[model samples]
Every structure is written in C-alpha cells, then in structure tokens.
Target: MALPLLIDTDPGIDDAIAIWLALAAPELSVRGLTAVHGNGLAGACAENAIRILEAAGRSDVPVHLGAGQPLARKFSRQGWGVHGSDGLGGIGLPPAGRGVDGADAVAFLAETLVQAAPGSIALAPIGPLTNIARLLREHPEARQGIREMVVMGGAARENGGNATPHAEYNFWLDPEAADIVCQSGVPMTLVTIETARSVAATPARIARLAAAGTRVAGHVAALLGAYVHDGRSDALFDPLVIAYLIRPDLFVRIPAQCRVATGEDSRLGALLWREASEGAPHALLQAPDPDVIFDLLAQRLRQLP
Candidate 1:
C-alpha cells in the first residue's frame, strides 16, 4: 500500500524539487500540500505549490495557504536571495489554473488527520513549524491520528547553524513554533542541517538530471542550475525527508530528545540534542551515503513525465 502523506512547505527552490520527487515516488500517496511562510510569502508558496503540481500533471492534489508569520516573532524578509523573490529561483512558470483551497492550513491539517486512519498518515513539514504548531494548539487531539512527522529544520548542534550563529533558517524563523511541536509528543524524526550539508548537487549531478529528457527533469535541472551557481552547495534538504520515508537505508537514525531554544539571544532556535530516554519526543538523523541519495533522486526524477 502507498504511504499516505501530506506535505507542509514553503516552496523554496529545493522545495519545488522535493514536491516533484514525492510525486514521482511510487511508495507515497501525497494527499495534499499546505503552504507556509518561508522561502516566500504564504500566498506565493501556495502558488508555487500549484505550479509544481501542474508541472508534474498532478493537479488533483489540493493546495492550501498556511500561516503568514511565526507564532511570536515578527516576519522578516529572508530567503528571497536563496529562493528568489518569486520562489523557484525566479524562473517564472505560468500561474496555476486552479485556486487555493478556502480552508486555512491548520484547519485542513486537522480535518485531514481526523478523517484518516489513526497512525496511517505521515506529515512532512519542509518549512517552518508554524502551521503544525498551530494545529497542535487548536486541535490537540489531532496527535492521535498522526503516524510520524518528518521535519526538515534545526541545526542539531550549536555550530551547525545555517541562518545565524546558533540556528537554522527554518527553526530560526519560528523557534516558538518549533518548541511547540518538539513538546507535542507526536512521534517525530528530525532531518537536520547536519545531514543536509553532507551531500551536495554538483554540476555533474545536475548534468545527469538534465540529460534525463523529461519535462520534470528539465525543470529540476533549471532550478538547480540557478540555485547552485558559484560552487554553492545544493544540499537536498527538503527532498531528504521524502527520501528517508521511501528508503530508510540511506540514513542512520539516532534516537534523541531535541529542544529548540526560543530565547531572543544569539542561541535562538538552537537545537539541543540529548540521549533518548523513555518517551523521548524525537529522533535525529545522519546520512551515511550521499551518493546513493543523489542517485536515487536522479532515478526518481527520471520516472516523472
């Protein structure tokens, strides 16, 4: 049976690639996409999600707009430089023909979880944790329905920060929300910056993708082309979450209890990892074979139309 899945995303340049990867994977049934404020505004993220599904000819999947800002912190102008102003590295695709779902992300999430079989649906949040956090706050009982939540955020250690001296961008954008989810007691697996930075998409890899001769492959190649210029790393951050679900052998899971710093100091959003005990909240991941992951990603992209 295909794994029931729902993705909450920000549609970053890499997010677009991740969505395509999930759509191409035969093992996952992506139920819907909920957009949050991260790589772009929530509205733009929803639009990008629609555009991505359109590109993959998977418009049957619904798209919903999510939280526009963090739970407590003021919104900041970030990610445009990395994901481009319009997201997708400003490689403008035509606007989506369909409209976003009227239901807000938090509501949609709650309804979806409640309606699905208990512990049968997986939630993948590749952006900030605002929507997930809100869902937990508004509908705490929804936890009973979730199978697992695979999150792509946080630096496992203090020195692993990608956005600041002590935080990753997604966690830094909404540390309070991260804190809420960390304590929500839902089974969680964290794919952190430590794992993402271990692998990169070099020009050679990009060439392999572009040579696949599929529309999806060409779109991914173009995104990577604009994303990984000047020797910049194109770590498959968001996609790794999806890949982990499809192929757990690609990584080693370290059971750990994680805490996100919600302080206003330099340590804000810093994830403190500790040894897991009874009833620990989450597990940290470490990738062992980046080449295997890259190969799998290429193989999957080639499967798309």
Candidate 2:
C-alpha cells in the first residue's frame, strides 16, 4: 500500500515541483496539503497548492491555509523576488478551481492524525514549521499517530545558511516554530541545505525534462528555467525531501540532536546540531548523487498528466 502523506508547504517554485513529484509518485498517497507563509503568503500558497493539484488532475486532495506569520516575529517578504511575487516564478497559472477546506490547517492536521492508525501517516513539511509546531503545541497527543516527519529546512553547519549567515530560509522565517517541532520528541528526518545545494538542476537537465514533451515536464522545465540563475544551477531543495522519502538508500544519514536558535540577531533561526544520548534523534542527510536524483525526478514527472 502507498504511504499516507500530509504535505505542509509554502508553494514556492521548488515547492510546486515537489508537489508534482509527490502526486506522481506511486508509493505515496497524499492525504492533504497545508499551506504556510514562507515563500509566499498563506492565501497565495494555498492557491498554488490547488493549482498544482489541478495541473496534475488530482483536485481530490484538499488544501488548507495555515499560519500567516511567525509565532513571535512580524512577517517579511524578503524572499519574494527569489520565488517571484506570485511564488510560481510569475508563470501566472489560472486561479485554482476549488476553494481551500473549511477546517483550519491545525485542526485538519490534528484530526487526520487522530483518525489514522498509529504509525500510518508520514508528515512532510517543506516550509516553516509553524503549522507542525502549532499542532504539536495544541495537541501533543497527535505525535503518537505520526510515523515519521520528513522536514526540509535547517542547515547542518553554521556557514551553510542560505537566508542569513547562520540560518536557512524556512527556519529563519520562524525560529520559534522550528524550536517547538525540533523539541517535540517526534521522530524526524531533516533534509538540510547542504544536501540540497549539492543537487543542481543544470541546463542540460532542464532541456532533458522539456524534451519529454508532456505538460507536466513542460511546467517543470519552466519552473527550473526561472529558478536557475546565471552561471548557477537551481538547488532541488524541497524535492530532495520527497526523493529521500521514496529512496532513503540514496542518502547517507547521521543521528543527531537539533535545536533552532530563536534569538533576534544574525544568529536568529540558526540550526544547531549535536550528538545526544537521549531524546528523539533526527536523521541528518549527508549527500546524494545529483544525476541519479534528477533522473528519478524526470522519470516521475513524466508520469504525470
């Protein structure tokens, strides 16, 4: 049977590609999508989630809006230019045909975990940890029902930060939320920026995907085209989380205790990793072959409508 999944995302350019990959994968059955504010505002993120589902002809999946700002900090749109103002590289997809679910994202998450059998659901959060943190804070009991959480944030090393000198964008957006989730004692796997940056989407790879000639492949190409910078390749950030879920063997993981710094300085949202004797240890990804991962992504995306 396919693994039941709940994807918490911000619908950034890479988030859209990751959503499409998840929908196309036969091993995962996406239960729902929860949108949070990071790459875009909650409303736009929710719409982007629905837009991706519609593109894949999988509108059966529900989209719910989550936290609009960080737990203790004011909101900022500093990264909007990186993902485009609309979060889809300004590709201008039509408005989603369906509306977001009525239930709040936290409620939906708690209810879904409560209703599912123990260890039957996998939660993948590819954005800020606001919703997961809020859910755990409100309903700590829900952690027992989760099988494992695959999170796409954090930087293992101090110098590897993408947002600030010592922070990745997702964790930098909400350090308090990141702290809550990391300390929640839930089984977690962290795919960091170091591992993601190792996998670059080159021009050759984009051309290969476009050559597939499917609408999904075309969309993937466009997103990658906009994402890849001059003389630099786009990092498959969010997609690496999904890729790890599907093939854990493709990566080398280490056991470590992680903590997010919530200070209000340059160190804000910096992820601190260390060895621990007790507590729920997180699997920190080391590295994976970029060619193999891109090939896998290309094959999976071609399967979509």
Candidate 3:
C-alpha cells in the first residue's frame, strides 16, 4: 500500500530532486503539491513544481499556489545562494503546459484532507511552514485526518542551522509558522539540516544519477551540477527528506522534543530540543550513522528509472 502524501515545497534545486523521487518511487502515492514562498516567490515555486512534474511525466499530480510570504513577516529575499534566481539555480527548465488553477491553497488543503480517508494522508513540507500553519489554524479538525507530517526544516542545535549558525532557511523564513505546526501535535517527523548535511552527494554519486538513463535522473544530475559549481557538494538535503519516505530503516530514529526559536535576534529559527521530561518521544532524525543515510540516498538515486 502506497503512503498517500501531500508535498508543500518552495521548488529549490534539491526540491526538484525530491519531487522526482516522490513521482518515481513506487512506495509513495503523491496526492498533490502545494507551493510556498521561501526559496522563491509563490508564482515561481508553483510553476517550478508543475514543470518538475511534467519533466518527470507525472502531470496528473496537481500543483497549488500557496502563501507568498510568512503570516506576519513581510516578504524577504533569502535562499539565493542555494536556490538562485529561478529557484532551480537559474536553470532554464521549460514551464508546464498549464499551471494549476487560482483556487486558494488553504481551501484546497482543507478540502483534500476532509475528503481523504482518516489518518491516511501524509504532509511533507520542504519549505516554509506557511501553508501548514494556515491549514492548522483554519481547519483545526482536519488534524485528525493527518497520518503524519514530514518537515524539512529547523536545526537540531544552535550551530546546525544552514542559513545562519543558529537557524535554517525554512524556519528562519517563518518561525511563527513552524511554532504553530510544532505545537499542533499532528504526528510530525522533522528532518533537520543537522542530519541532512552529513549526507552530502559526492561527485561520483551525481555522475551515477546522470547515467541512470531516465529523464528525471538526468535533470536531477543537472541540478546537482549547478549546486556543485555553486560551491556546495551536497544534494543530500532535500533528497534525504524524500528518501526517508522511500526507506526509513536506513536512518536511526531518536525521539527528542523540538521547538523553533522565534526571537528577533541571531538565534531566530534555532531548533530547541532536549530529553523528554514528560516520558514521551519528541522527534526522529538521522542519527547513530549519518554515513548510512548518504549511502542509502545514493543507492536510491541510482535506482531511479
């Protein structure tokens, strides 16, 4: 039985790979893609999601436009070093034949969860938590329908943030949204950059992906090339989020309590977590062996068809 999933993303380069993995892998049933503004504007991110799906020949999946910025924060310009101007590293991938309708994303999200089987839908967010927060706020009852939420944000510690030494881009972009989602108690699996940075995609791994003989693989490899030349060697960030859905056994899960810091200081977006005092597990991340995650990600990318 494939796990039904709804992806909320900002269409970064690694986000493109994540989408491909979701569409290509047999274990996941991707119900839809909801775009948010973080790596780029909502319009660009939504367009990129549709373009990536069509590139993978999976246009049947719907892509919905989401919030243009955080709930309270004014639109900020960030995530350029990684996502670049076009969100996909300025790579000129052609747009889809037609984008999704102009229906409001919050309504789309509420309707989708209401219609799906109870506790059968998984929400995987690879960008800001705006859409997720809105869903929780507007339709609190829909929380019962969620199986789990896999979020790619927050840092496990102060020094682990990718954007700042204290915060990751997704959380820093919208800490209020992260705070709301975390306290919602909707069974979430947080995939932090602390674990993801350890699973860097080496040159050889990128080469292997490019040689996989699939269009999706080739496009992902191209994105990897841009990332590498941009002075980063890891496609491990976003792919690990998708790869976790495909293969969870490869990572060691540590249930620890986590919270995002929303202070207007250098510590904003930090992930605060400690041993559970209430005798309950908190969040699971790639632990014990980070190398195991890199190996698993490479193996899965090689298997792309």
Candidate 4:
C-alpha cells in the first residue's frame, strides 16, 4: 500500500514540481496539502497548491490554508523576483478557487494523523515550518501519530544559504517556528540547499518531458522556463524532498546535528549542525544527486493526467 502523507508547503515553482512528484508517484498517498506563507502569501500559496493539483487533475487531494506570518516576525512577502507573484512562476493556469469539503488544512492535518494507524502518516513540509509547528504545538500527542516528517529547508556544512549568506529561506522565514519543530523530536529529515542545489534542472532534461504533450509536462516546462535566473538553469528544490520518498537511493546521507536560529537579522534562519555533537537534534545531508532525481521527476511528471 502507498504511504499516507501530508504536504505542508509554500507553493514556490519548485514547490509546484514537488507537488507533481508526490501526486504522480504512486508511492505516496497525499492526505492533504497545507499552505503556509513563504514563497508567496498564504492565500496565493493555498491557491497555487490547489491549482497545481487541479492542473494534474488530482483535485481530490485537499488543500489547507495555513498561517499568514511566522510566530515572532511580522509577515512579509518573498519578493516576486524569487517565485513570481502567483508562485507558479507566471505560468498561466486556470483559476484554482477553493478545495473540496473539509479543505481546512489545519483540521485536515489533525484529523488525518489522528485517524491514521500509528506510524503510518508522514508530513512533508517544503515551504516553511509554520503549519507543521502549529500541528505539533496543538497536537503534541500527535507526534507519535506521524511516522516521519521529511522537510526541505536548512543549509549545512559547505552549503551556504539561498535567501541569505548563512540561512536558508524556510528556516529564515521563521526561526522560532523551525526551532519548535526541531525540538519536537518527531522523526525528521531535512533536505537543504547543500543537497538540493546539486539537483539541477537542465534545459535538455526539461525539454524532453515538455515535448511529451502531457498536461503536467507542459506545466513543468513552463515553470522551468520561467525559473531561469541570470542565465543559469533552474533548480528543483522541493522535488529533492519528494525524490527521497520515491527514490531514496539518489541521496547520500550522513547523520548530523542540526538547529535553526531564531535570532534577529543576520542570524535568523541560520541552520547550524555538527557531524560530531553530543545531542544535536536534526540530521544533515551533505550532497544529493540532481541527475538521478530529475530523471525520476521527469518520468513521474510525464505520468500525470
């Protein structure tokens, strides 16, 4: 049977790719998509999540709108220069309106985890830690209800930050929330820029699938085209997390200690870790292969309706 999972995201273009991978691959049964304020606003992220799913013709998967801002920081939008105002990289898509019955993301997360058999549900947070943090805060007991939580955030040794010099976007958005999640101690795995940056999306690779004439392939192609920044090819960050679920073999892992800083400017969103530490909470991955992951992603994207 497919593993039941929840995807908490911010719907960046890469997040859109991640959603495609989750829905296309049969290994994961997406219980619901919870939106947080990250690559875009909560309203746009929520709409993007549903739009991506609808584009793939998987509207049955519910989308939940989450927090508008972090716990401590005042809410702000990640400039459209990064993810575009629509979060789909300006890929023109049909209206994504609302989701199905009980589409409230928070409630769906609570109910799904509670109803699931112990250790059967996995939560993948690709955007920020807001919703996941809230889930744990409101349902500390539900930690056991989650079999695992695989998230895309943080930067480790040798890998710097995407949003800042030392911090990654997800954690940087709200270090306090990330801290809450890491300390919670539910089994967690982080896919950071140190690993995801290596997973490049090449023009040739993207063109192969874009020519397939499938709805999802075209959508992905459009996203990739819009993702080009300063003549450099785009990187599929979120899909690296999903790839771990579909094809874990593509990643090289090392168990290391990790923590998110909740301090003021220049320190916020900093993900710290040590390979040799007494009780470092999070695990750090040094390198992840993009070719293998993109190959898997392309194959899966081509499979969508």
Among all candidates shown, the one with the greatest lDDT:
2
Candidate 2's residue-wise lDDT over 1-305, tens digit each? 89999999999888998899899899999999999999888998999999989988998999999999999999988777787767787776777998999999999999999988998999999999999999999998788779999999998886888889899999999999999999988988999998888998888988888876779889888889887853233788999888888888999878888899997778999998886553446878876678898888888887898
Residue 243's lDDT in candidate 1: 92
lDDT of 3: 0.79
**Can you rank all candidates by lDDT, best first?**
2, 1, 3, 4
Candidate 4 residue lDDT tens string, 80-131:
4676656677778888866534556666788788887888888899988988
Give me the overall lDDT of model 2. Answer: 0.88
Pairing residues by index, what is the TM-score of model 3?
0.92
Off by over 4 Å in 4: 97-104, 229-233, 276-281, 286-288
Ranking by TM-score: 1, 2, 4, 3
lDDT of 1 at 70: 93
Which residue pairs come into collision in candidate 4? Answer: 64-105, 172-269, 199-290
lDDT of 4: 0.78
Candidate 3 C-alpha lDDT tens digits along 96-183: 7897766677778888898888998888999999999999999987877788788888888658777799898898999999988888
State the C-alpha lDDT per candidate.
0.88, 0.88, 0.79, 0.78
lDDT tens readout by residue for model 1, 1-305 = 99999999999877898899999999999999999998878998899999999989999999999999999989977646677667787676778898898899899999999988889999999999999999999998788789989999989765788889789999999999999999888888999998898877888888888887799898888888877883445787898999998898778888888889987688998987797775666888898677787788889988888
Query: What are the clashing pairs of model 1?
Result: none
